[model samples]
Target: MAAAKIKKGDRVIVLSGKDKGRTGDVIQSLPKDGKVVVDGINVHARHTKPSQGDPQGGIKRSPAPMPVSKVAHVTADGKATRVRFEIRDGKKVRIAVKTGEVING
Candidate 1:
């Protein structure tokens, strides 16, 4: 398997879709599906009748998974940047292409 360019907890900016121009932390990463879920982004509502799991299963709002291509990592200066892998001290690390700074997980 290839290394992940984006991972959970990465601060990213939406490049397209209704949430474009918005920035948030990555809530989940679905590398297999090439998708990710960002906090407070791409939210969808689910309405369900009262279910056994919850006595009041009303409208539930939650973030939905979006294609990984739609998002970019945010640098320290708050600008969007592409990610690159680099070998540092015998360890592979992610770097921000724009700022050339190492990104910590």
Candidate 2:
């Protein structure tokens, strides 16, 4: 994978599509596919028959994976920003392009 910038648990803002301008936490990351599933973003409804655990499994909404490029990292102040890597204190760390803040993925 080509250095996945967004990791699970990071807050991100949608850059385009239906969820543009909305922010959510990254729930899952598919490094190989270069996609990320964010909470409350790209959700779609699915119909399923009643099951043991979910008796009313009807019209369940779940998040779908989106291209990693579609989302931008959110800074501590809640602004969307691009990420870059830099060597800091003998360790490679991600820095926010807008704020120059160190991001902990």
Go through the candidates in order and give each one's C-alpha lDDT: 0.95, 0.93
Task: Give the TM-scores of the predictions, in the order they appear.
Answer: 0.96, 0.92
Displacement of the residue 3 alpha carbon in candidate 1, Å:
1.0
- As for candidate 1, its clashing pairs are none
Q: Which stretches of candidate 2 lie over 4 Å from their true place?
A: none
lDDT of 2: 0.93
The best candidate in terms of TM-score: 1
Candidate 2 matches the true fold with a TM-score of 0.92
lDDT by residue (1-105, candidate 1, tens digit) is 788899999999999989999999998999999999999999999998997989898999999999999999999888999999999999999999998999997
Deviating ranges (above 4 Å) for candidate 1 = none
Model 1 misses residue 27 by how many Å?
1.1
- Candidate number of the best lDDT: 1
